[model samples]
Target: MPRAILHLLPLLMLACALPAQARTMSAKIARVTTPVATLEGVEVRLDWPADAATGELRLRAARVDAPDLGYRFRALEWRCPLARDGQGGWRCDGELHADGGKPFRLSIALATGSTDAALSQGKASLALHRSAATPDDTILDLTRVPFAWAQALSAQAWSDGRLTAGTLDGRLAVRTPEQRPLRVDGTLVLADGGLETPDGSIAAAQLGGRFHIDYRKPAGSTLLSLDGELRGGQFLYGTTYVVLPGRPLPFALDAIGRDGQGWMLPSIQWRDGAALQAQGSVAFAPDASLQDVDIDLRSHDLSALGARYLSGWLGIAGLPDLEASGALDARVRLAGGGLSSVDARLHDVAIDAPGKGLAFTGLDGDLRLSGGAPVDSELRWRSGALQGITFGAATLPWRSADGTLRARAPVSVSMLGGQVRFDDLVVQPPAGGNGLRIGFGLALQGLQLGELSQTLGGPAFRGTLDGSIPAARYADDRLDFDGGLSMQVFDGSVDVTALSMERPFGVAPTLSADFALHGLDLMAITEVFDFGSISGRLDGRIDGLRLVDWSPETFDAELHTEPRRGVRQRISQRAVQNISSVGDASFVGSLQARLIGLFDDFGYARIGISCRLSNQVCVMGGLRNPDGNRAGGGFTIVEGAGIPRLDVVGFNRNVDWPTLVERLAAVGSGDVKPVFE
Candidate 1:
C-alpha cells in the first residue's frame, strides 16, 4: 500500500470531526489549513440537526500534496456518523481508505476542548489524542505498526533509497504542537534483512540491531540526540567492512536539521570497535556533500587493528604475511581534511611475517607526530630473528620533520656473531611520493661467514664479512647501494660493488652487482664442495652480473689460477674428467692419451677459462699463452708442465648458457660422463 495515504490520514480525520462555522445552521464546510501540507479539492459535510446539540460529518478529497513529508494522495474519502451524548460530547464511527483490499476503521470521541481518535487496519493500529490544555497539539501513539506503511511515508528520509527487505517492530510516542516543534521518543528493533543507499554511502548484509531514539526539533541550528547499538551483522560504509559477531557498538550523536541549510552534527561519540573509539563532528550540505569533519580516533590494541581493520591496507605495505599481537595506544586526530596529529605508544609488541621469515619481540616505543612539529621516537628491540639471523636487543632513536624520518644517532645491533650498524638513516612513510622512500648508511663489523654459510645450508668456509656501504637509497620500488661490501672466506676476499635492486621485497625482483674474487685457495674451496682439489691461488671476477627473480640473467666472468712461488699446482684426475665432461672438450699437448689415465693427478703451469655471456650464449675463452693458439687456433684451459702432463682444451666457443649450466650441475652431482670431442 502507498504509505503516502497514511501520512495524510491525520488531516483527513481532522476534516471530518471539525466544522468551519455554525452560522449557517443547515450545513457548514471548512477547508483544513496547514503549513505541513496543502489539501486541494477537499469537501466536508456537517449537519446540525438541532442547530447546536447534534451533528453528522462526512469528508471527501480529490488529492493532497504535502511537500514537507514528501507525500501525495488522490481520491481520498471517509464517512462517519456523529451522535451527541448527554454531556455535550460526540462520538463517531467510520470506515476509510480501501487500499490493498483492506479498509481502515476509525473511532473518534470529542468534547469542546479535547479529542481521542483511533484508526485500525488489519492487525496494525494508530491512536491520536489532543490535550484539553492545548487543543492545537496532537499526541500520536502507535502499536505494532506495519513497516510497509512507514516506508511509503519516509521515502525522502532515505535519500531516495528504500529499505528493500526487513521486518520492523517498534513503539513510538510523538507530539506535534501546531507549528512550533516536533518531539519523539521511540525504541526500534530491526531484523536480519538489509538496506542499501542509492549512492552506496551505506549498505549492509545480515543486519540486525536495536536503536533507541530521543528527538526534539532544533532550537537554533542545533540537534536530536540519537543512541543505538549494532548487535550482529556484516556492515559496509563507503568501503570499510566490519564483521560484527553480536557485539555492542554503542554510539550517541546529536544532529540539527535546518529547513534550507541542511544538517549539522555538533557532537558525536562512538565505540568504533572493541579496540577503538572515535569522537567527531560532521556537517553535510543540503545536497548531501560532506562539507566538513573533525575527528579524534584512538585504538588500544594494535594487534586487533591489523587483523580486523587493517588487512587491506597492510597488504600494500610488504607485510602481507602479518600476524601481530601487542598492546599499543594510539591517538589520531584528523582536521582540516587531513591527518593533523598522531601519538602512539607500544608495549611488549610482537610481530611476525612467517612467509618473509621476519619477527620482532618485546618491541616498545613512543612515537609522536604532529603537523608543524618535529617527531621523536625511541624504539627498543629486545630480541628477535629474521631470515635465519638472530638479533640482540638494541635501541634505535629516530627524529623527523618535513615528511622524512631520520636517525638521531647510529644504531648498532649484534647479529651473526658480529654487529651491524645503521647510520644517518632517513625514511618517508608509505603515503609519501613513490610509495615509500629511504636513504641510509650501513656498516658490518666482523660478521662470521662460516656461521652464515652453515645456517644457510651451504659450503662452510672460515672467514669474516666486514664492509661498509657509504650510502643507500630507495625510491620508486628500487633500492641502490653505493660502495662495496667485502667478505674474507676460502682464504680470499670477495668484493662486491655497484649493488642495486628493484622491488627487493616484491615480486620477481632484480639485483645487479659486480664482484671480484682474489687470493682464493682452490684446495680449501674444492674440499668444502667435495670436488677434486686443484692446489693453487685462484683469482676471478664477474662483471655486469644481473639476476632476475634470483636467477642469473647476464654476466662477464673469468676464472684462472697462477702457481704460487713455492706451491705445486696440480689438477686431480677426477677434476680433469669432470671438466672434460662439462666443457665437452679434449686433452691436448704433451700427454700420451692412453697413459693419462695411469696417473691420479698431473702438474699444470696455469689454468684459465672465461665466459662472456649475452643473449643466452656463452663466448668461451682460455689461457693467453702463445702455444694456446695452435694450427686450429684453440686456447688451452689447462697447460701441461711435466713429462706426460695433461692439458685440457675447450673447443666449443658458442655454448648455450643454459646447457653449460646444466652440465656444471651434472658435474657437481657426480653425474658427468666424458663426451668425445
Candidate 2:
C-alpha cells in the first residue's frame, strides 16, 4: 500500500467508530442553507434528550448547489452546537467542511431578522446577510468573501485557466427586487494572486491589484467602469514578459459589451513611470475571437514603452542589447485590428550596448507613417556603430507609408576597409502580424579582403573585394542577395552568387551560395598558402555550397589547372608532396624514384580535383580519363610532361571531410613537411 494511505488509515478508522446505543436519527432533507451554498438530500443525527432546547447535531450531505456561484459541492458535512434562541429562532456554531479540506469555523443564525452567517478559514472570511423576503424581493450580501472561495464558487467563469491563490477584500451590494439583470457595485482588492493558462502562454508568478468595478446589464448589454492600480509581479503574455512594480501602476477604463456587438473600451489611461494614453474599442466573436479593433495611442518615451509593456518585443527584434534614453514622443493609431498610422519624433537620443549589437549617439529624427501608403520623414545621427563599423554624422531622408520605410535616395557608410552603399533601401518594421522586410541595392567598393578576413577571423587572403547587389531583400527572418559578389584574389576574380541566409540573428544561422574561381595564379596562391611553389593558372567552382552555423555542410566543388599555350605548368617537389598528403595518395614517377628530391620542380601536363560532399564524406575524384579511361583504369591526376616524368594518383575515392580539413590545417600550420616516398 502507499505510504500516504497507510498514514491516513488510522484517521479513517477513528472517524467511523460509533458508540453503541448512541442516539442516531436519519432524516431525508430536501434543502438546507448556508451563506455560500445550499444543501439537499441530507441526513442529520442528534445525540441529545428529546425536546431539549440545545443539542449536538451532526449533518451530512452528498451534494450542495451554490447557484450564486455556479458551483456544486460533492460532499458537505457539519458538526455543531445547536441552540434555540429565546424568540422563535435557532443559532448554531459549527465546523463546515467540503471536499475533504480542513473544516471552516462557521456561525449561522436563522430568523434573526432574516439570517446571519460568517464562514472563516485562517485569515480569510466570508460574511453574509440574507433578507427573508419573497423570491423576487430577496437580497444576498457577499462582500467580505475570500478570493479562493469566490473562485471555487464560480468554477465555470473561465474554463481556460484557474486562479490559484489570492486574498480579496471588497464590498458588494446585490438587489433582486423584480427579475432584473443583477447589478453589482463593488470594490475588490486582490493580493498574492497567481494564474496560469493550460498552454502557458499567459502566466503570472504573483499578481496584485486593487480595482473599483461597477457592473450593470440592460437589454442584452453589459457595461463596466474599472479603475485599478496594478502592483508588483512577474508576468508573461505570449512572447512579452514584464516585471511590474510593487507599488502602483494606475489605470482606468470604461467599457461595454453587447450580445452581438462584442466589447468596446472608449477611454483608457495608464500612469506608471510615465503616461500611456489610449482611446480604443474592440469586438470579439461568440467563441471569444477578435472581430475588430480601433485604437489611437500616444507615448512620450520609447524606452519606457518597452520597459513597461513590450519588454520582450525589442529582444525578439534583434535589438535586445540596448541602452536608450532621451525624449521620445509618438502617436499611433490602429483600426480594423491593424496598425493604421504612426507619427513620431525623437530628440537628443543616445543608445549603446556592451554586446556591440547596435549603438547610436546623438540621434534626432521625425517619422511620419500611414498604413499601406507612403510617408515622409527625416533622421540625423551624430555617430553610430554596428558590429564595430563606425560612422560619422549622417542624415537620412526617408519615406514610410505602404507598410515599408525607404530612403528617398541611396545612403552609404564607410567602414572596415570598405565603403558600403545602399540604394533604394526600404525597411518595414515587423508589425501587423508580419515579419520585418528590408529591400535594397547594395554596393561594396574596395573592401580589403585581408582586413575583412581578420575581422571575421577567417583565412587571410589578400585582395580587394568589389561587388554590387542588383537587388536584395529580407523577409520572414531570412535574407537573400540577388546579384553576385566578386573579389580579386591570386591575380584572378572570385565571384559569389545565389547567396541567401536564414535566421540571420537567431539560432543556428544558415548561409548558402555558389562560387566560381577563374584565372587563379597558382604561384601566387601557393606563395600565400606557404604550399611550396607552383607555376600555373587554376580554375574552380563550388555549386550548391551551404554552411550551417558557420560550418560547411554541403557543396559540389572542383579545382583544376587551366592549360595555356606557352604557359609553364610546373609543380615543385615540396608542392607535389603536400598534394599527395592532402589527397592521401602516392607519387608514381617513371623516373628514378630514389632521386625524386633531386629536382626542385617537375612539369605536369594536367592537375585536377573534385569533391562531391554529402553526409560528412567527400567523394574525392582526380583528373578524369578524357581519353579512353586514361590507358587502363583510374584517374590521371598529374600527367607527366617532361624528362623527369612524374604523376600522383589519388587512391582514395572517399575521404572524410574532417580528415581533409585536418590535412589542410597541418599544411597551413607547417606541421606537415614534405617527405619522399
Candidate 3:
C-alpha cells in the first residue's frame, strides 16, 4: 500500500519467519562463555485463526537429551504444556527427567522468575526454597507411602537399612550441599523392621509402642525420649542378656541417660520367678560388648529355687521343698564376660526344708565374692539347731541344740572333698541327763585314727587336719559338736584321737571312748623289769571293750614274751627240794648210821625229782625209810646223808600221811641254796 510500509515488510517478514513473540525486545543476543557457555530467552505469541486473540504454537521432539552441558548441567528432558504468565520469564508445569545426574527424575511447578530452589528424593521428599541473597529454610515431611516402599527407599539411600516413620514433621536448614537437611519431631513407630550399623542390629519388632524423637539438621542425629511399655522385648549383646515384657514386667524399670557408643539400663523391678526384685544399672560397649552391672535384690524364697539358678554354686540339685524369706542387699560388677566384684548382706531370714534339711533362725551374714583374694564372711545363727545329722552314707546320726552359732574367720572344712570356709563357730548342747557339755580348742591336720575309732567303736585310725574344733555334748539320742578342730599326724598326716562325746551316735545312757594308742613301738618294749626273775621281751594288747553305762563288760587281751640275752633267771630252792622228795631219792638207814661219826649233813650223788603237783603233798615209792614204813602209789623218794653216804630214795605202799614228812624236812634244810636277788 504505502511506500514506507513496503520497505518494512521484509523486516517484518524476517521476524515472522522465526518463532512467534508475545513481546519484542529491541535487540536479542546469545553467546557462549567459559563458565556458563550460553544463555537465551524466548517469547511466545499465539492467535487463533478461527476467531480471536487465542492461538497456540507447539514445539515437539520425540526425545531431547543432553548428557552434560557443563559441570553443573546434566542430561535432561522436559515436557510441558506451555502457558503465558505476567512475568517476563518462560512458564512450564510438567514432569522433568535428569538422567545421569546427581538428583534424577523430579516433578515441579515451574514459573520463570528470579527465585532459586532445589528438591531432593529420599525416604521422604524434601524441598528447599531460597533467594539469591538469603539462606534456605527447608521442609522435610515423611513419605505417605507404605512401609515397604519407604524401607526400600531407605535401603537404597542408606546402608542396607530399613527405616520408616509412622508420623513425622520437622524443619530443616540446608547450609551445605553435601549433607541433606534432616528434620524430625513426631510420634514415630517402627514395626517388623530393623536398623543395622557396624556394631549389630536393633530390630524394630523388639521395640514396641509410640516413641517421640527430636532431630537436628546436617547430621540427622537425634535426641530420643521414650515413655511406653514393651512386651516380649529382649536386648542382648554377646554375654549380656536382658528382657522386658510388653505388659508390665514383674518390676518397674527406668532408664534416663545419654546415648553413645555404650548404652545404659538403669532400673528394673522383677515381679516373679526366683521370687526376687532388683534395681540396678547396666552398660555395654559399642560393639555389643559387656561392661559392668550392679543390682540389689530382695528374695521371698531362696531355697525353693535350687533347680532354677542355685544348683551350680551349691553342687546340690533338688532339695526338700523349702520356703525362705528375707531381705538381701547386693552389688555386683561385671567386665569382659566375668564378675569383677560382689558384696551381699542378708538379714532376718529362715530357710525351711522338709524333714529338717536345715533350720536357721535369725541368721545374719555378709558375703564377698570374686578376685584372687579369699571371700571373707561372718554369720550368726540364733536359736538354730540341726536334727538328723547324717554323713549321707554313714550309720552315725545326731541332733543338736538351740543356741547362738557363729563362724569367726576364714576356716575351711571339707566334706565329700568340697570345702566350706568358716571364720569362728560355737554351739551349745541341749539340756539332758549328764549330757556331754564340752569347750574345745584344737587344730588337727587331719582325721585321727584313734579319735575316729573311739567314736565308732573299736579299730583305731589316724589322719591329718589343720583347724581348731571346740568340744561338744552328746546325750539321750542326741549329740552336739561345737567349735572346730584341726590336726596333722602319721607321716605328714593328721590324726584326731580321743574325740569324746556324751552319747555317741545317739545311743541310750551314754558312751565315751578314748583311743589308747596307735602305731606302737614293738622294739622298745620290755623296759620295765620284774616278773619271776624272767628277763625277756613282753608284748601286750589291751582293749577297753564294751561299757554299758560307762563300764567295761567285754574285753580282748593278748600277751607274748621272748627271752632276752645275758640275763640270769633262778629257780626257787623250795621248788627243787620238794621235787627231790617226790622222786626216788633217799639217804635212809645207811645214811642215818654214818651221820653219828663225821657226817652231820646230807648230799646227793645224783639228785632227781619227779612229782605231780595237782595235790599239795610229796609221796615216795620204793626204798623204805629208817622206820621201815612205805608211802603210797605214784610217790617219789629222795636219799642223802653224810659225805659219800650211800643214799637211796624210793616209794613202796601207798604213802600214809605222817610217814614222808620227817624225811623230807631234814633234806630240805640241808641241801637247798639261799635265794638273795
Query: Estimated TM-score per prediction?
Result: 0.69, 0.78, 0.30
lDDT leaderboard ranking: 1, 2, 3
Root-mean-square deviation of every model: 7.9, 7.4, 29.8
Candidate 1 per-residue lDDT over residues 1-677, each given as its tens digit: 33223344444345444553452222223444463455666666666554555555666666766554456666666667767655666777788763224678877777666777777776667777766796444566665555555554345344545565655556555555665654556877766646667876766667676787766653443346778876777755544556665776787888876766767788889785646677888876776555566666666566666655665455555666688777777665544334455677887888887766688999899776555578788889788887777789988787867555778999899999999999898877644224678989999999998888888777687889999999999988899999999998888899999999987766677999999999898889888766687898889999999999878889999989966788779888878887777676688743346777688888888989888888989888888768775556466888877876777888788889899988877777878654433
User: What is model 3's C-alpha RMSD?
Assistant: 29.8
**Top candidate (TM-score):** 2
Error of 3 at 230 (Å): 2.3
Residue 170 accuracy (lDDT) in model 2: 76
- lDDT tens digits, residue span 1-677, model 3: 00111111112222334333443222232322211122222122233244322223322122222111101222333333433345532333334344443332232322332322223345433333333344223233333222443343233223334443332223333232323533333444434333444444443335343344433332312222333333444443322234444454333444332334444556544554444566676665544445667777656556444433343323211232445666566776665445565676777766655433455566667655543344445544444323422112111111222322233333343332223233333433322223223332433343444544444453343443356445544344444455433333332322233344443332232433322223322122111111112222333333433344554433333333323355222222233333435333333455444442343233332222222111323232322233323333332233332444533345543343334445444443454332211
The stretch of ten residues in a row with the least summed lDDT in candidate 2 is 1-10
Positional deviation of residue 405's Cα in model 2 after best superposition, in angstroms: 3.3
| Alpha-carbon lDDT, every model | 0.71, 0.70, 0.36
Query: Alpha carbon lDDT of residue 254, candidate 3?
Result: 45
